[model samples]
Target: AEAEAIVRYIKDNPSDNIGVITPFVKQKEYIKKELESNGINNVDCGTVHAFQGDEKDVILFSLALSEHTRPETYAWLKNNRELINVSTSRARQQLYLFTDSNALERLHDPSQEDDLYDLACYVRSAGTYQLTPKPVESRALGIRPYSTATEEAFLENLTHALDNAFSDGSHYTVHKEVPVSQVFMENISSKDYFYRGRFDFVVYRRYQKKEIPVLAVELDGMEHLSDHIVKARDEQKEAICREHGFELIRVDNTYARRYHYIKEILTQYFRS
Candidate 1:
């Protein structure tokens, strides 16, 4: 939630004047990778120490952890006044703070007051974004909608680009939520972990009546970062694509925004 929100803000704003400060170096590095993957390398991102003597036009502060994920660390951070003070005061124009709702669900030690809970209330973002997507749950209940806002926008633009590129009777078509194993022509081994893993979209080239699988695309956002399981899944997907002689484009939200950038990428493998 923190990473996606931060990346979206940076992509739309697109300035070196922006800064990101997270409480932990682990989360800070995770977010940095997400930004860099999206081709956003200019922003200064680090823990509070990196911003001690600096300010930015826009500042995003992410708690970047839930009690469930890291209990002792979160317990320590939620009460640290210095952490909150230094992080929030660095923003010149706009300040956005993010934390998971689950993190704030449990009460802090009432014996000693903590400012982070108070801060979460003002932001109303102790995972508010995580719960507020009612339309996603209402509309697509079965198999999607974690970060549907980003995915929806990207798919709309990508679909349009694909249509325009194949204007004279479109030859290739895009499919969403497709299984990774299906991309292969050969039979599957029963023990593979990613056999049931799904790709964001698969593009197939149509020749006569047969639709040949031509390319695969994955939209990676902040969710893809920091999770060891997700990283392992990515490595498996890449390996599968390589072994099967299939073309896979692992795109960041940065690349997904531009219809032209996506179009240019597809044209190399699937020119109409």
Candidate 2:
């Protein structure tokens, strides 16, 4: 029933990604099954101690503040502080905290507020942390941005980066608009320095065979970044891609429709 409610919340607000963290693995499994049975997608829960270096945009910290009443209870309270610090750091925009009022009062400390205030100030000071839109500028004909030498250098630089990233055999990938299944080819060779994964393309030319670079190619009638869901999806995809080693490459739809800028980029990837 709770899982159904969570799924309904997600479906109604598609912008949100659900993340659940608790102090028990059994609970995680229970919730996972409940969520799956109810058709909830991407719901994860695990022990608070197990959650580190991971984050969600919105987090529901369920630890009761009132539980830490005794000085000896401070040890248990320490976990809550750690979870709060880690959880708050994970959100890029917002955070949702739930607990009893008694617990909130118990957890409230003037010094803690100062620390949180400092962190919040730092977050706000990040100044959007969003990429500025590429402006449309017309260049004069024959004034090419790519000289043979510079182009080769640029290609080499990109190739080297991709190669280095793909040195790891296992990596994440993000494909924009392009179906996940179509991202990789089956005939990838050991010498090819790239491998096709179950979902996306893997770049393996860099190191030994450790990495797989993420790839993204835009395929909308127009740029889809303007849409919030599209943008969020793109962000989520990019995040997943980064978790592996893939980089995103955006191409105008016309690039493929006309000559083949997409192919050109791929060729350049190989050459680089």
Candidate 3:
């Protein structure tokens, strides 16, 4: 839908030196194919890296990843702020991003709190030319809501339990939905850990005045039991955490109801 709109706009405005920027090679090819099929052949489409050292009067960026996509699927783009900078800055006069608002909101990385989410908010507020369809509660521009009620309830409950368990002396702080990219791993390249995964919750113990990460937690849903990809990713995360000497605690959703068990697991690490 976004690509079609862009092509149509370019067709209407023949004089604008418009370019399409995508994060993945396959996406670039897909956009190029769409443009050619529509008989709009003048505009150039390429990945952000390919467009470096080049500038366009107007640049259309297609953020292809949706809320359902796993972080590892686009870890390279998510971790590399330089690539986003290159893509956003390549436009001399105008820049437009085609992204799902819900996906942008649901981005699960505190490290990107300023970079991605804040930038999106800034652009929405500051940009002069805006084109958004009418708001619909059931369907948000053809994108379904990202989080289900069950997930939201689980997260809330877990957060409340952690707060109650750790609120006594500030011995530990519980952070939710922390990106693995923010946590540095020893003897590993930045490229290796970039966007690899995210912890559902992280417990950081206070040492002197600084907070040090001590435990990473994951709340496994039923999907993790049956999904091979999810299992593989979880294994990879466990390996990385072990390599870095960070204890990872995996709890099934069924076990989440057992408050005593949860507290016991957390207390064991918080004291260590």
Candidate 4:
């Protein structure tokens, strides 16, 4: 749940200076690994003991100890004044606490003034949020300003192929790093989860003033994901394009670099 929250938060606020604080070094390392595996590597993650002087625009403080799992550690955490204080005080704009809410409720005694119990009360004052997990899209990973060299090569090969197939007239146009919403002609709202989605390439046919999309291309790499996760994410992207009345193609690295194969695909699609 903590990993999921961090991933979703980072996706929504891609540019924010984010940091993650956890009581245990193990949790800190695990969160860092998960983020990197998901192609998110910008946020800083550390233990609360070393986070005293640190402040970020947004901080995700994780109470790694839960009453059910580790009662002794949970008690240790609940009584530690300095740990709770440092964890709650290091965010400039937003501080999100990730914990077992049921545990918090069970541990908080209204009759007693405890350090961690008081911190739990404070978070409740700020309003507790339960984040439900959502589908993690591969196309939405690695938010960047520029396209990869592999993607650029695929576009160049596709462009040349288009020229050869439609020598008599312009039958197809190819674009790179196009936004998914723009391709689908959907109005973007801040609440839309896939608004950050971008097609690695899009194939279109121009009609004087308007360009009609027929194909959306995704250049697949290890950066997005691998194995079964890659298959699932690819299926999701394909379904999304199908819903928007276009074909979505995912090109693996070796195939993406081939000029003849790219030309052949353009010819087959636009020739008919």
For this target, which candidate reaches the highest lDDT against the unseen true structure?
1
Query: Which number leads on TM-score?
Result: 1
> Superposing every Cα of model 2 onto the true structure, what RMSD results?
17.7
Query: What is the lDDT of every predicted structure here?
Result: 0.67, 0.41, 0.64, 0.65
| Least well predicted 10-residue stretch by lDDT in candidate 4 | 137-146
Please give the RMSD to the true structure for each candidate, in Å. 14.1, 17.7, 19.1, 16.0
Q: Which segments of model 2 are wrong by more than 4 Å? A: 1-12, 23-41, 64-75, 78-82, 107-272
What tens digits encode model 1's per-residue C-alpha lDDT throughout 142-254? Answer: 11212344466678787777778765786777788898767776534443745767789988878899878888888864324533445677788777777777788878654
- TM-score, candidate 1, is 0.49
lDDT against true structure, model 1:
0.67
Q: 1-272, model 3: which lDDT tens digit per residue? A: 66777777788888999989887787788889889998887898998667755667888888776767666654555535555565555665677777777775566475532334434544677643222322222212111111233234445665666677775666666777798866654535443544757787787778799877877778764335433455666777887776677788887644544567777776676677
Deviation of model 2 at 211, angstroms: 26
Q: For candidate 2, write residues 168-195 as lDDT tens digits.
A: 3633323222443344443222322223
Q: Look at candidate 2 and tell me the lDDT of residue 117.
A: 27
Clashing pairs in 3: none
The C-alpha TM-scores of every prediction are: 0.49, 0.32, 0.43, 0.43
Please provide, for model 4 over 1-272, each residue's C-alpha lDDT reduced to its tens digit, 9 standing for 90 to 100: 77777778888989998889888888888888989988987888888766645557788888764555555666677656556545544565677878778877776655643556545554666734221122333122222211344456667888778778766776778887787777776542332434756777888888899998878777664334423444565566666666666777666544655788877776676666
